[model samples]
Target chain A: MSHKIKGGCQCGAVRYSTDAEPMVTFNCHCTHCQQASGAPFTTAVAVQRENMTISGDVIEHTQTSDLGTLVHRFSCAKCGAYVYGISDGFGATAVNAVTLDDASWVEPQMEVYVSSAQPWTHMDPALPKFDKLPPMEES
Target chain B: MSKKIEGGCLCGAVRYESDAEPLFAVNCHCRHCQMTSGSTHIPGIGLPAAAFSHTGDVTWYKIQNDRGGQSMRAFCPTCGTPIMGQIEGEEILFLHVITLDDPGGFAPQMDIFESSAQPWDRFDDTLPRFAKMPPMGE
Candidate 1:
């Protein structure tokens, strides 16, 4: 169960744990995610904001996502490891998927912003893809 | 011929420019990279130290690798971007290629630290793969 999800920043300056399973998982290929994550895509694990217990200080950077929604990204104040994010665009607090202590349980539900994905990025063909965001029923 | 490479963090709070050609490019699946990038691996380019410049704030987080060498992760504080990394005593700086002004420019030639790779990670299956860090001269 994803209930055991726990992780911290690379420097251990920020640590977090959540006892609840993620409600949604997405692989975002938007340029904003690409630049922010320094990877072709970001696997975002969405969970209830109240379910997480975080220790240590974190600084938030607010930015308008490519979809024109406000997404607040957070990084460890000292180490700069991206930890998690919050946005009105979605129902839950999104954790940077790999930031989990163990991400082997992750299986992205869908791929978004495929139009902005890096040419060399290899993705699983079995997963659904979208050129941009798909119609969503935000909780 | 040398070409200039330029890029920055997502929020435009940090910028960097390099005039030297990269020595190599690869995708690293080390656990540290996974933790930092929040992705499967790091698509980075190894560049020589000279003729590189950057502006704005960057936070560096240092960690000891499985090999026991210290490598520091450099990220933008304002935007939370994984900017680059450096191994202590090493002359090269590995910059995350996805942060480039033109993210389309990255051409990764290999994969490293595969022993720690996740099962869900998918690759093109064309590049050479190393179980761990590759011998530099090879």
Candidate 2:
């Protein structure tokens, strides 16, 4: 079943909508994600890059991933709220789950980069945890 | 026990150091925190404002809390990394835990603002939970 989702930054300066369901959902515990979210980890919902429509002003910053791929992070210029990320390694764009208007449906299927996770940070025991990004399956 | 710690933003444009140990640590589930950090909750280490030294430029945004209190959030404009938050009329400056160079050292003793927490976000059941910020001494 497919449904539309909507969200925006804190200042309401940046908004986004997608009619596609997330292909996969996960939580990242990498150091980069920690820095990006200023939290233990960040939850992400991956959707087809072309399926999402984003509007308003956003600023982008690029960083090299642990796998040596370039990851571009986008955030609201006005409120500094992280909106999403695009990685060269992953063809899909990952939206920050916290930015979603309705987050009750978000259920991460896996935890990546668990080796870098802080000791005090907790994760769902039921979700598969990988020390690093698991080998991607062919779509 | 006391320790010195250092940290900076992703771009390294904003940096901070503190010699004083954290006065307290908490996992905040306030909506303001979720919005600013772009996460379910923010783990923070409260430090005395006077004991912290910061360098480089930061962009500050002011937000009103549920109680109509003023809150100031600061982040690095270059990297969009949240640095710290300050409650109006409060002397403590809460540093984002993940911003610390050694974030593992942080151990949250409590969870606050659980009432505003997203249903999907899980918390450690062992930690004390408060519907709101506990009284100053409690």
Candidate 3:
């Protein structure tokens, strides 16, 4: 049940699309993601970089992830809306699910970095939770 | 002494300091918040405009409500992290809670704009929920 996924920045300065199925969708409660997104957690739809097509100029800001891996964040320069992230910790590009044209279909498989999650943030208990990133095979 | 509430963007380019205590904490599930933050919702704290000070080059995006009210969202140009938002005609400005140096101890009173919330987005059932913006000025 895969469909074309599309989305863009709030200001319409950037846009992206992909027909490839997402590798995995999960929530990231890492402090870096929290600060980067201004949300309690970031829902990431991991996809292959080669299958994704992006238009418009994106500002890349590289920083150290909570995992101590170098993560490259790409966002719209005009609106500062995050588009996707590339990090050494994962093999696929982590696309911000909320940025999708219709994010209602986003279903997270797990919640990571629960140790850094805020007390006010309520999550679905049915999903598996981890204090930090689990082994790639286990994730 | 308690810790000071101060923070900046992911790249440490945009910095802010708030000396006052939190006035209100809320989680907005509006579509705009989702698109801007690239997350399910935005958890922010409202503070007196006078007490909060910030420094850095910020990229501002303006959104107009159906009632003609305007809201301004500020993000860091260097790091692309949203840090602040200002509502027109309002005395207090809202800051993203996660922007705080210590982004803990935040307790949101309610959820607003649940009408547009994504299905996969979860919430605390204990908190009050509103389909859209609640009536202001009691």
Which regions of candidate 2 deviate over 4 angstroms?
A137-139
Superposed model 3: Cα runs more than 4 Å off: A66-68, A137-139, B1-3
Best prediction by DockQ: 3
Instruction: For residues B37-114, write the lDDT of model 2, one tens digit per residue.
Output: 777899998899999999998888887777788889988888899889998888899899899877877789999999
Q: How many pairs collide in each candidate, listed in order?
A: 0, 0, 0
Interface RMSD, candidates in the order listed: 1.4, 1.1, 1.1
For candidate 1, the lDDT comes to 0.82
Residue range A8-107, candidate 3, lDDT tens digits = 8887888888889988899999887887898889999988767778888888888876666688888888777877888666656788887887776778
Sorting all predicted structures by DockQ, with the top scorer first, yields 3, 2, 1
- TM-scores vs. true structure, each candidate: 0.93, 0.95, 0.92
Complex DockQ, candidate 3: 0.81
Instruction: Please say which candidate is ahead in lDDT: 2 or 3.
Output: 2
User: Over 4 Å off in model 1, which ranges?
Assistant: none
Provide the interface RMSD of candidate 1 in angstroms, 1 decimal place.
1.4
Candidate 1: residue B128 lDDT (0-100) = 93
Q: In angstroms, how far off is A90's CA in candidate 2?
A: 1.2
Q: Model 2's lDDT to the true fold?
A: 0.85
